[model samples]
Target: MDELAAFLRTRRARVLPETVGIPTDARRRVSGLRREEVAHLSGVSVDYYVRLEQGRARQPSAQVLDALARALGLDGVEREHLHRLAHRPAHAPRRASAARPRPELLRVLDLVADAPAFLIDHRMTVLAANRLADLLYGRRLQGLNIARHVFLSEEGRALFADWEACTLDTVGHLRLSAGHHPDDPELAALIGELAMRSDRFRRLWVRADVRTRTHGRKTYQHPSVGPLEVHQENFALPDATGTELVVQSAAPGTAAHDNLRLLASLGATPAPSAGGGCPAEGGDRGGALPEEVA
Candidate 1:
């Protein structure tokens, strides 16, 4: 199915029948709201909605798009995304080179010395990170790809206390990124690799979940400092459509904060080499660390 169609279907699947006052029926075979139900709710005919899903309909009017958005219960980000997919010109050519984070932005990351800060592109490539973030993530962040590390590396599972939630959120954010840059070859390759190497990633990808990371809390089972909870904040880089600076910190005066300070202290010290060096407790085992929390 086309991108717009697949996205609509997936969003439809997320809404329960009872959510919109639709009576649940035992005879229903499909998950979430059926196409007919959506058609009724959106004030469109079943055939029209079917054609939209089948990629046969004309460019939908803004009114129609808004109606459909409400019917699907899309959040602000998701709603904007739906409009973009519907209105985006087909097969548009893209720049040959992927955009990188600016040096000034890297300087900004440096200024946030006390917190774990890093820059990532839409594809979750760790463009650069502060020393604290480098120490926090270790080898996994070194390879530059966050999703790959989370799904493919054993250390990823050990780092995250809520591994499944982290994986799902990562996949969802990737999906959102894909919608914005549908023609990016590297993004396509990353998705293809994950789908091939990880069964969990494959399942989540097919669901077409989309999420935007702004601010959230995450629990990390830090190998060095034990368990810690940190607040993650993401800032979009100005003039950089696909790159973001992510900063993670714990509340002051909390144990988590003390652990974060300890991490910062460790980061200040020189890292030990693989042979005869002070290895991080349950560190990446020589694998690259994943990107900052999404």
Candidate 2:
């Protein structure tokens, strides 16, 4: 189903006929109030409502949306989602730029040694990651896309304690990204790939949910460190549109915090150097020390 239609159907299903003053009857086969009932409640014609649900209607006016919102008993978030689905242009510009972190941002990331931090774009592509984050996610994060990992990689299922919740949140964020950057071919490609590979992803995508998760608590089952819970916060970068710096922290004095510190230390340690100094001119410096030391 199309986004608008799916959104409307889902919202309608959450409301009961009896609660809306519509007499519920045993003969009613529908799960919730029917399209006709919603039309009557919203003061719109039955045909118009049906057309709107079928994606045949034009962009709904604010008044119409408000009426429908009232009819569906939509909360503030749901109402805003309804408006976005109804008003988004059918076709948007196809040009989408890749999100890149600035050098200054990398410096900032270096300063954040106590927490696991990374930067991600609208597509949840990891633009940059600090040592702690790299250690926490391990080699599985090489794909650099969180959504792809969640749906396509077995590691994702083992990493997150609440896998279903994580997947739902990821999907909702992607839906919001789609709304903001409808013309991004990369974003479209990512969605198409996930839809093809994951039945769960396809089902959630059709729900048309939109959410921006800036702060939340996450539990990870680290292979080496065992279970750890951390509070995650995302900060938007003004210089980079559709890019966010994400940091995960555990409360001070907690065991989780200590575990994270250990993880960071493990990641920060450089590999053993085969050669101590810079090699002779044109000679290979296999595992040589970095330039900062030389």
Candidate 3:
């Protein structure tokens, strides 16, 4: 279910009405173009698109895959994701899922020069964060699971300006991911830990809130970089179950963008240093939403 839900959300977000030349008007009820519009543009049947989104159609042929890639206006990374989901096979018993990021993925994360990037499993742990990620958010993030830290730790609260909203939203997004990998023991243990540790998490988990995280703005109070506003992009890893390459970028020329680039250049960051320096520059803390709302 997690695999299916994730694929559907990814496919839907990758497409836009304007990408296919559809009029952007008040008639739009959903986030992106309608399923029928996507099918019509891609030369597939509406029923097929619906089936695919609903996760009922498991096997998409090569031709269908090509059509979806075109219709969704997927970039190189997204196109690869479409192919991966199309060919996903039902898992067999005794599956020993990975607790770390893939080696190839770590290489790719290092290759990213501009923004801090890393890979996170379903529970959103800091499995493989790069140097930049370590430098910026690394101080408070050390040895901490993202979900646990966000809801339980004071550092997490300080890092995020809108603490409650962001915590709730991220929890919801994690819920959606959990549904697809119910049998994955790592994910299960993560959920169990949260349930016991945080009362807020316990309530949210009981409500069964699930959300597909699409594009959005996230505010982080970086120790060195001060305040940074980044656009969060999650890309699925090829042949990896419940893994995503989470990349974050700031709008060009902003204070955060400039400071972050400088911080990255300095390099060789120490682990969780002291001092309350604000860098004398930052992003506006108002109106930044949580990781949910897709």
Higher-lDDT candidate of 1 and 3? 1
Least well predicted 10-residue stretch by lDDT in candidate 3: 278-287
Please, what is the TM-score per model? 0.87, 0.84, 0.58
Report the candidate with higher TM-score, 1 versus 3.
Answer: 1
Best by TM-score: 1
RMSD after CA superposition, every candidate: 5.5, 7.9, 11.4
Alpha-carbon runs more than 4 Å astray in model 1: 95-100, 140-143, 267-294
Ranking by lDDT: 1, 2, 3
| Highest-lDDT candidate | 1
* Deviation (Å) of 293 in candidate 2: 32
Worst 10 residues of 2 by lDDT: 276-285
Q: How would you encode candidate 2's per-residue C-alpha lDDT over 1-294 as one tens digit per residue?
A: 467777888778778888998887678888887998999999999999999999899788999999999999987766887888788887866644444455677777779988888877788877667667767876423226788777777767788889999999999889888777777898998899889989999999886767788899999998878888999999976642577889999999998998887776665442222221212111121223221110
Report lDDT (CA) for all predictions.
Answer: 0.78, 0.76, 0.65
TM-score ranking of the models: 1, 2, 3
